[model samples]
Target: MRNKLVEFKHVSFRYGDDQPWVLKDCSFCIYENEWVAIIGHNGSGKSTIAKLMNGLLFPQEGEIYINGQLVNDTSIWNIRKDVGMVFQNPDNQFVGTTVQDDVAFGMENRGFAREDMLKRIEQCLHAVGMEAYRLTEPHRLSGGQKQRVAIASVLAISPKILILDEATSMLDPKGRQEILSTVADVQQQHALSLITITHDLNEVTQSERVIVMNEGEVWNEATPRDIFKEKTALRKIGLDVPFVALLTDELREQHIQIDNEPLN
Candidate 1:
């Protein structure tokens, strides 16, 4: 069995005492090198969970652990060293004047040896297929290209876990595909665990496991195929089913027999 990389035990949180709780006794585990997707409607507290995992925000109740260490003020930086996050907007992550420099920004902050930083820049850029854009300014790149650079920058950190918190929500279909393909290839090459937080149900079909959140609590956890099979249940929680699941339901209604379950 794979080691547990992240654990949330009875966690709960909110912005303040006056605000309502955002997460209510949420609990889950993400295993090493696994791809897990957290899906929920807006205000379901999915993004809040991501912030808590990396210590951007601490839970008002319960606990969060990363790589076997509890998340607190003192351990947050260390936790971040093992976890990389790419948020919804790729533009928000760009800091360098050029592509290569952008990839080096994190390493610079971490005090990577200059020689090692240069080498990692080349390797990460190539891994994300952004090598040819090495000299391009951040603003000049397309949305997809910018996200590729962001991924390259994160890869330079060599984190054990990567969190895509609505990473593709701002992109067009083509841009979304670009990021999805890039993430899959790099995850294999780097042996990194992936946590994708998204409301786009279609983007999550490839994950090894799916965690569905509703009203600030974990509603269900299952394999992607198993989760998609409950199209009616998923919709009742305000989540739409993927194309394949809907198609399967239609086929069955038409009396067309399918030999096996279909999940796209």
Candidate 2:
């Protein structure tokens, strides 16, 4: 059996002591090197779940494990080193004035030597296809470019798992495509476990596993093909089929012979 990289055991969380649970008994396991997508509507606890995975938040009633080690204050710093996160807004995440500086910030914070930091920064920028922008100001870069820089910053540390919380939501269609291509490149080459939280069905269609959350629980867990086939069930929970899936459904209705394989 494959080793589990992240685990949540009856995990639940709320923002305040008196508030109701935002996530309730949210238990799931992500394996080493797997690509997983968490889908849900606004206020459905998807963000909360992502925070828990990387130790940004701890469970109120249960436990979370990273690389088989239980996450607590004692182990959170180490766990954070192994798990990297990229939040939605590109502007908010950019701290370095230049692209190179931004990519090296995390390594610098971790006390890497100057020589090693530069080397890793170069390699990471190249990996994300942003080597040319090394000396450019981050403000001059496009949305997609900034996202790649954010990714490069995380990659410089060689994380075992990456969490993207709608990292592409603010980009244009072309920009989103560019960032996703970068994401594919990293996942393919590094075999890094990825957890992407997005409203876009297009993003989840490529995942090895699909998880749909509703009202703070795991409402559905299945392959993309299986989940898309149950359109009514998804619609009931305020989710829509992927545009490609809907188009395929329409064509199949008219007797078109299209392969119904899950899209990537």
Candidate 3:
């Protein structure tokens, strides 16, 4: 059985008393080793949930737990140790001049022994297929290559849960594919729990489960196969289903049977 790595119970958040709630009564759980995708249009509160989970923001109501410990100012530091986040802009996340230094940045902050940092840097860079680029400067690498380095930096810490907050949004189709493939390999090799916050339906198709956020709430939760089945309902909320899903829905409507699940 998978263990619950993260949980939100009736969570609510707002910037201030006068502000409208950004997250309203949101609840969900991400289990260890599960790859879950959180998707919605802009201002859907998906990103807020990501910040909340890491204690970057605290809920005004309800509770969030990471690794069974409640998320609060006091516990946040420790919780973050178990949850690593990579954001959309690869350039923004890079702090090291060279790939090796960037990958070692996180471990260095955590006060890992110099020897340990070197070992982890090597391992993580190899894991992300950037071992050859260890001496390459961040600016010299492509967007996809930089993102892989960012991912490698996060992995150096060995966090149990990895959150990719629109990490692939800025990349081209090929770059996006490369990062997704890297993430899949990292997750499988390390048994890491993955949460991808995205607007892309293609990303959703790769997840074990999907969390649909709409208007500051969790509109629905189901596997990609089942989520795509509700094409009309999804479209109503200003979200587009994948092309394969749309075609499958059309075929099914025409009284044709799809033996295999669409876009699985």
Candidate 4:
């Protein structure tokens, strides 16, 4: 059996006492080395779940576990060591003047040795195809390059779980594709669990599982192929299936069978 890397049990939360519940009775599991996407339209509580995972925002009514340890005030700091997050706005995430410095910032805080940080930085930058731009200033890079540097910074920390909270939302189509492909390659080289929160159904195609959130609750949880087949169900929750799903159906109608998986 696979080990559970992150688990949410009856989790609920709100920003203020008068605010509406952002997540109510939501529970799910993301397994080790699994790439899971948490998708929903805006205000559907998807991004809220991301903040809760790293203890940036604690649940008001339920328990969150990371590697079996309960998430609380005392455990939050330690939990962060194993959970790294990359937010949507790369501009807000950058601190260092140059690309290499930005990637090394996290390691420096964690007290990684200069020699070791240097080696890891090179490997991570290369992993994200950013090695050639290491000496360039972060502000000068394009949107996709900025996100790649952000990812490399997270990779330096070597967290067990990585959360990309709408990390591609601000990018253009090409930039978005670049970030997604980079993530897929990086994920293949590591054993970490990935939780990507986004509204884009296309982003979830590469995920092992999909957790559909609606109205502050878990609407559904299933493999991408299974979830894609349930077109009506997804539409009811305000999500539209991607073009691939439509193509799949067309091929099916013509009696064509894809011997492999529904998506790559």
Candidate 5:
């Protein structure tokens, strides 16, 4: 069994004292080095969950534990050290003028020596396959390249857990695919735990677990195969089935004899 890295214990949060709970008694455990996708519609609390994990937002009720340490102010810094985040907009995330400088920004914040900074900068850029453009200005890179730079920046911190909050939603199909491929490569090589908050089921097909939320509550949680089987349940939550899954279901309705399950 995998080690438990993070746990949400009856966690509840709201924007303010007057606001309704954005996350209602949410409880789950994310295992070490697991790639889990949190799926939901807009306002379904997926992004909120990401923020809570990284200490960007504190729970109004209940508790959050990172590596078995409670996420109070005393432990927030250490919790954040282990959990790095990549936001949706690539342009919004860039802090340095050049690609290499961008990747080095996080290391500088963490107080690494200049020599070690340079090494990690190069290593991270190469890991994301953007080493060739080390000196290039951020504006000159494509959308995919900019997102890769963002990923490299996060990876430079040597974080144990990485969260991508709609990181590929703003990109074109090809660009999205490029970023996704880079994420897979990084996870495979580094054993990084990953939490991907996305509406795109296509990107999450191979995720170890799928969590579906609706109206700010965890509506369903299951493996991909089981979740994909609940066509009516998925439709009720205003979520469309994967294209391939829908097609496979159509074939079944027409008496096709294909043995494979939808989008398996």
Candidate 6:
């Protein structure tokens, strides 16, 4: 069995004393080299979980562990080195004037040696297919290219877990596809554990596991095939079933047996 890379035990959180809980009794484990997608409606607390995992937010009532190291004040810095997050807005993440500079910024902050930083910058940029744009200014790149640079910046840090927090939401369809393909290649090449927080069902279909959240709680956890089977429940919670699943449901209503779940 794969070792657990991150874990949440009976986790609960709230903004303040008067605020209602944003996460309640949450428990789950993300294993090494696994690709998991977290899906939910706008206020369902998916992003909150990402923040908790990276130590941006702490749980009021439970514990969170990364590589068996508890997420606390003292360990947070160390934990963050293992978790790299790419947010929705690529523009917000860009700090360097050029592609190579942006990719090297994180390593520089950590005081990486000049030679090592140069090597990592080269490797990561190439890994994201952005090597040719090494000297390009951020303003000249497209949204997809910008996001890929953001991803390269994260990979340059060599984090064990990669969190894409609505990273593709702001892109057009072609841009979105490009980013996903780049992410897939990066994951395969590096054996990285990937956590994708997205509302796109097509993106969720690519993950090995699906986590559904509603009202700050985990509503369901299953494979894509099994999760899509509950079309009515999903619809009630403002989520849509995959198109292929809908077709299968219609065929079933006509008494046609689908021996295999098409999207599984």
Error of 5 at 151 (Å): 0.3
Stretches off by above 4 angstroms in model 1 are 248-264
Residue 134, candidate 3: how far off, in angstroms?
0.4
- Give the lowest summed-lDDT range of ten residues in model 5: 255-264
Which residue pairs collide, candidate 4? Answer: none
Per-model lDDT: 0.91, 0.88, 0.91, 0.90, 0.86, 0.91
lDDT of 5 by residue, 1-264 (tens): 988888998998999999988999988889888888899888999999998897888998989988778988888888888998998988999889999888888888889999999988888999899999999999899888888899999999998898999999989988887887788789878898888889877777767788898888888888776787887888888777788767766787899887755343
lDDT of 1 by residue, 57-144 (tens): 9999999999999999999999999999999898889889999889999999999999999899999999989899999999999888
Model 2: lDDT equals 0.88
Candidate 4 lDDT: 0.90
Query: Which is the better candidate, 2 or 6, if ranked by lDDT?
Result: 6
Off by over 4 Å in 5: 247-264
Q: What value does the lDDT take at residue 29 in candidate 6?
A: 92
Q: Candidate 4: misplaced stretches above 4 Å? A: 257-264
Q: How big is the positional error of residue 110 in model 3, measured in Å on the Cα after superposition?
A: 0.8
Q: Where does candidate 6 have its weakest 10-residue lDDT segment?
A: 255-264
User: Model 6, stretches more than 4 Å misplaced?
Assistant: 248-264
CA RMSD of all predictions: 2.3, 1.8, 2.0, 1.4, 2.3, 2.3
In candidate 3, the residue pairs with backbone N, CA or C atoms under 3 Å apart (3 or more residues apart, or in different chains) clash, namely: none
